[model samples]
Target: MNITALKPFKITWAVLLCTFFSALAHAQENLYIPLETQHNALVLSVSNSHDLNIAYYGKRLNSDKEYSSVLRQYNQTGDYSQVLDAAYTSAGSRNLMEPAISVIHADGNTSLSLKYISHKVEDLDENISQASIKLEDTAYGFNVSLYYKLYKKEDVIEQWSELSHNEKGPVELTKFASGNLYFRDAQYYLTQYHGDWAHEMNPETSLLTHGIKTIDSKLGTRANLFQPSVFMVAMDQPATEDEGTVLFGAMEWSGNFKIDLELDYRDNLRLIAGMNNYASSYKLEKGEIFETPKFLHLLSHNGKGEASRKLHSWAKDYKLLDGNGERLTLLNNWEATYFDFEEKKLFELLKDTKELGVDLFLLDDGWFGNKYPRNNDDAGLGDWQANKRKLPNGVSSLVKEAGENGVKFGIWIEPEMVNPESELYHEHPEWVIKQPKRKEHYFRNQLVLDLSNPKVQDFVFNVVNDLFLENPELAYIKWDCNAVIYNAYSSHLDKQSHLYIDYVKGLYNVLERIRKKYPKVPMMLCSGGGGRVDYAALEYFTEFWPSDNTDPLERIFMQWEYSYFYPAISVANHVTEWGKQPLKFRVDVAMMGKLGFDIVVGELEQKDLQFVQHAVKTYDDIKQIVWQGDLYRLSDPKNTDFASLMYVNEEKDQAVVFNYLVNNRYGQGSKRPVKLGGLDPEKRYRIQEINLYPGTSSYIDSNQVYSGDFLMKIGFNPKVGKGKESVLLKVEAVR
Candidate 1:
């Protein structure tokens, strides 16, 4: 044979095969998958090792540009043999960062190596599209599916993970985070919310170092000691409201949760967020699946302000229950009558409510109980029945009276707690969450019910169901949980470790049922105030009580911090009689969110009453803007003696600005120029001061019309005088 002639032909064929394989590998590496919204993109790609990595997460990129170089760079870290940029970091692998999922397999294997198997993209709706990536363990039957849903218009992305195994034995899940995110080399600053009972949602920013910083809640139920939300800014300098790259997210779980920010030795950062796996190790039997709560996040190139607006828009458009609905202005009798209220006292309060132009009349606590009257926090928590001593005619009569007075009726109930002296507790002691011999601890003289029990769940559901059934005219329900879970035991569950997860699931089950049955009715979630303020509960409830402390000054700081991740429509702010501040100041602060009065309205002087009436009417006119608008925090109270904020509607036609003199400075009576934001710069607007004292003139020239550019750039000065002084300005496009 002609060996030399055959060799050239063989070499030519081999070269063609090598070129084809090389192109195939290059194409696979360049297979960029993007979960994108209108302005943002969470782009992912598969590495040469078949590991999925977040290639880019920020402003949307040009569609024509190839992203293979970016993906290669992201996965090419020199420090470790394996890249630490896994889309969903799993433990028992080469990755040294905090793992998003950690488990002990049936084979007693603590390590897992997940390889990308498949992927799918589906359009859930006009505004939402979901991208899912499937992965499988290299040596086990375990499987995981990572999901990313892009809320297109809101520019927000929600991520979650689902895990399952086909092994014969049960798998122990030690840690299961909802989502994991990795950022390349950058100086990181974290803005997290933390505070105690009355001072919920206090924001504190700190520079991230070469270790893990954790924000978590051990409180079984409220989960408010530290909110499951954070903002991570990746920039060389400190974070600013309107500048830098900001990554913000919230864990949509009402139970105990944790968020960990791990800044690696190379200045890179990894974020792990989800259920707190403290004592709640979940066991997944064969063929069973576990799904983590949705961890919603968004990336903003324009800074934290844009991140907040995007989140608010997403919550209002999709996540929040009845997000588009207008929250009512109500008058609650908590501060007025408390547990001392009777039918007659409520009727008088209803009269005052009607006179003040309040939309709804909420009868707070003390209306329930039979033999052990709920006259105080010490008793009658489990009894949902009307108190024969306080309201002899039951809640139906109050509903009828409220209706007659031209106001809708609402009632407060703590269905998750039971007083030790109550009939329900006496009859079913096993229903309480307590260990067999461990001494039980009580908060507010009440114990938490074991919602992990189906029977207890039924009872709690019936408490709400029966109220609406008995009083068909019931307009609203304020669900309160006054006590945190103690003893950490569930008699109904075989695994005591499953108590926390099971309890939250049961509560969600009951809430889901109630919501499905009464989809239109408004429900407020109040867990000793701001305790249960999480996205998981907001799915079923309309609004939440931000805090028990309604002092106007304190709320200014609290609500400001809260606005970072939550929308104004979801915050139930009330004008209370806690501080010695003026009634106008209180009403103005309350008007910032959902307007409600908790003060004794009947005791108001004529001038104060007139001002109250004016404020209620004013809030109604601007409530839509406040609820559905973009919130721009013009001035942070934390840094200045004066705090200012503004809300501008989507159409750029209507806006409202609020200026508060938090404290009287040494230069009292000085004029402070406050700039406004979120308005159409080219449009001319007319300004008017509302909810003012009868004889007092406006601090700004209300008659003048100015362009939005002037208002935002040059600005106007509010006549500052005494501390606690505030002014509300209404801006309307001059047609």
Candidate 2:
């Protein structure tokens, strides 16, 4: 928590300093609670009953009147709705306004009062600032503390709430949101990402109507595709790719969670987000405290791109992904040899793998326990041992050989599942999650292990730990979980257990053990594909496999939206046969993220193979800028015939642009200049072509100098040839 990294450094709000200082000087008053960053401010005032109400929460506060209290000034008299509103609008109570908390005491009562206990400035670091408000209901022996921190440098407010009890008995909570937020107006466009399985993290936006729009996940495993934990609300109309006022929020929990935006009768917006109430009610004993997952909130007058930058900056600064990363170029054996592997075949693939300049080799599924034999999806899961029949030489031998050949080794594992045919499952039938007296359900011919139990957690951890200890050369692990919770009941927990949250906790605990032991090894999270990519899982894994669908055209849309909240280096992109090479579109798409190859290189023709080598060389040349630079989404794939993306370094000294036309268009010979952003306006840049594959045309003349302003504002048109085509260009600032 280096508070300094959270706040922005620019000084646009300096003119309002006098008024802000005057208002802040009086913020010590019992009736006023204010938190301000360099440009944004949140003001709240205590009501007569001691509950805090929202005054303002947007751009910098220039006057006390800007956040004038409505509840404190208005004198309510007649109407029942208005009367009810005046009487029951507290954040900790269950009435008109949404309650941030709802806890049940020993007597089974859910109502409690949260009186203002105290407020203080937690940190005043020049880069970041934080404030805290503590509330307590001594009568019920319950207390809550809300924390707010602003990264003045990034324009982001990270917030969450903690609940604890002092009574001599256990207390249960039904609903505990991070915090309840109030907006002054109801007019907003709610933007959300909703998809299932292969189609994950798809962005969509709609106007907020007069009802509760909720995005939630009840599935035990982050509900990867069903309901994501991030959202944005823009005023008036939805923001374009690069413009408008928007408020964004994302809960950083990889478990069942909820996010709701309610427009009450009063035409104001009420937002509450945190752990989902779906099949979750955590019990807290006396002297124990529970913390809700953090929710990142950001306000941007400059549209989704800027708001997203704030998120990316915070995530990177916090090391949310433990990302010490320049993601490697590798080759995964899944598409090349799924459930099919031998020492010779692996060695044969290694030849092309080395020739293509891939530094890492990932052995996909099929090297495991003999009982199930990994013959297909039906067997060989719960067992972590190498299949003696498939690889008689052993995993250590493979690792040693790969290392000897100048390639690092990684393995794919689905540690959270068990096939009924597995030896472990046969020995411990009680380990699988199933109902007490009902038919067991299965997906991919497998059942989920009851991770909530310590025994199961230990079992999973030991399997991976043994592998790493035995083969010190193991460089990475692709951890995959491929099923949903069709039957989520845990055989190990009590009847009232919160299976959803507990399950994720158990999974996290297992991951923590492995991370502690193998701190340097990078892990990629996958669930079938892109299922568990979020900040929660990011804590343990360095990146994720964004999709099993490697169709580059579709990825133009998926990866485009995916980059909105994540860095390119955190996505595992593979070049499969489809979008096949040279056209080389597949490899070009894969190069946009953590590049890898999924198809067998041996099957390629000589010319295409040569093209593959050239493509890899080109990728290596531009990967630094592609993975580490700020991404500017030029044109969305879905809206038009072409999709364009640009990556620029922070100093704006260099950049790389990617352009693709999914389908060939007719009747047009005109060139269209692609304007780029985030450039040093006065500097001149030498633009050069970076394309290596055939069927592509050079977008710009090589070694041509142009002012950054001219390049960004009146840009160079792409030299796109006929038929589905793409081109890559590199720009370096020059004298």
Find the number of clashing residue pairs for candidate 2.
14
* Deviation in Å, model 1, residue 56 alpha carbon: 2.5
Best by TM-score: 1
lDDT for residue 355 in candidate 2, whole number 0-100:
77
> Candidate 1: lDDT over CA atoms?
0.83
TM-score of each candidate structure, all chains considered together? 0.94, 0.91
Model 1, range 374-395, lDDT digits (tens) per residue?
8788888898888887778888
Best by lDDT: 1
Segments in model 2 whose C-alpha atoms lie over 4 Å from true places: 1-30, 62-94, 124-126, 579-583, 665-671, 694-699, 721-724
- Superposition TM-score, candidate 1 onto the true structure: 0.94
lDDT of 2 by residue, 149-224 (tens): 7788787887888889887778888788876677755388988988876677788788887778889887777376
